[model samples]
Target: MIHANRWYAAATAAEISTQPTEHVICGRPLVLYRAASSGKLVALENRCPHRQAPLSMGTVVGDDIMCIYHGWVMNGAGQCVHVPHQDSVAPSVRVDAYPAVQKWGLVWLWIGDADKVDETLIPDMPWTEDANQSSVFIRFHVGANYQLMADNLLDVSHSDFLHASTFGSHAGRKAETEHVKAELDAWSEDGAVYGLRTLRDVVLSPMAAAWAGTDKPVTRTHKTCWTPPNNINIELIMENDENKVTIHHDHLMTPENETSCHYFLIWTRDFSVHSGYPTDEDVRREQSTVIGTEDISMVEAQQRNKIQFGDPADIPGAADKIVVAVHKRIAELQNEDQGLSAT
Candidate 1:
């Protein structure tokens, strides 16, 4: 079952202007738009209840949307406000309306009971509002289950082998090996799993060196936190005695359906903020190459394998501790949401 009570990042605020946008979250089709009159963001079921036509294909008029099929109009509250050919609007003719808000440069939609929504549960992205940090946003449509992507972030040991040329370095590999052999501390708080690790005296990869402005050995700290129903934040710090660089990553995934998802990513850093050492396009290209070419390909293949052969039984290792914990937490949340006790 979907974690209906949580907020899901649907789209970037800039993407929804005067036109209606369509998004599928938690297996539900939603249409998002800003009212032309009030400029308020609104989310409603995408389909018109009359003929089952997609509301997203219709045009916006004032604070309401007109169905293209028959010119029927529905307001932001999903109330059937006007019917072109009818004398009176029936009170029962209305679609479902979802609560939506814009924060941290993104549009967030609540998929469940509106009365139960807690604003504090919306994960924070401090970098998005920080004046000292430069941020870049990108979105990807991944052909894999959202949970697989979460697992990938929880266990980043794949970087050494999967991202050899970009993020792998001899010293980084050595540090990773040692870190995997040692115990990793992961705990759950407020329905989220957080894992933190610090690797000392590690060699920096080219990308890390460029970001840190140094090629010497340094201490690297990686912190990964996963919020239920697909939200991940990663804070990476590269520090030498004199210089320190911090990169904060936000991974927001919303399920398009059972087998696919929409991945929204934001990479914010304090390195060379005003110097433009790395252009936005340059950073976008590098990240796109790594995640698009490397991670998505691998995860999609994993999904295909799962589809071909049911869930395979595999032994967990030391490096999989965090990933396993994340799965267990998800199961707990789902069970609780459905009013069932965990066995």
Candidate 2:
């Protein structure tokens, strides 16, 4: 229910350090650093109140950030600790602070109204709850609304076209989606918080069965959910006639602006191509046109139309059933924002 209470990715695991790092979240200029004494990462608004200088430009000396402008010092909580050229303690001036936690190999911060930041909304991954998964990490950035990119991912149909040159399987596409099963999943509020693994089935159309020569369906079962304005988590198993199972996940994180997103992922058991991890780089290397031109062309076009036009086709259809369900949930969350008066 908070405006910006959700946690977001601050930096890659390799970049976080005792040295203070400045970043903007939800459009709030913030700085992150490790405590000198405890080595715990902390987040604070980066601007100095006196002259509006960035405190992150200062030094991280002994558990405090010393502003380079005037040697004004602040502690981990953004509480002012010292003001040079004066003996009297400054009347407890402090910069805004955000709750920060480094988990899953990324620094997470809560940036909405702090009072409304529910820890539960911070996001929990039970599968990543294990330590070994720590070794797996993947990162990528796409220029698009975190939501649009997520919707594109929620449906695998794109793989047949967007990825056709590399991942195309005419047998797979012509394969009867109807034979696979049509599942209409939705939340009256939001959409795609999958509970029953909707996209996990192995039924091939007669074409695929004939091509792959499998009498039965070759199903890869999956469960996934998207957290807007930018984030996604998916877990799935890939299966062939051999009946062996491999597990994988796609993890996404969004910055405050919703213009671009970061992806952190793991391929514990699944191959990179199937996971969309390597294909991302492959498309970049082999077909720079698709990743660079096509993706940008589409997102920019979509943004233009989105600005000029109203919501496109609010109703739900076969391909858009998932999108409609998701729009519903987002509408629920933004409902309060809708009712507020300009006054």
Number of the top candidate by lDDT?
1
Q: Report clash pairs, candidate 2.
A: 4-112, 26-256, 189-328, 189-329, 190-329, 200-221, 202-219
> Candidate 1 overall Cα lDDT vs. reference?
0.81
Worst 10 residues of 1 by lDDT: 174-183
Q: lDDT for every model? A: 0.81, 0.57
Number of clashing pairs per prediction, in order = 0, 7
Model 2 lDDT tens row, 81-138 = 7888777656558888888777766777775666776666645555445543322455
TM-score of each model, paired residue for residue: 0.93, 0.73
Q: What TM-score, to 2 decimals, does candidate 2 have?
A: 0.73
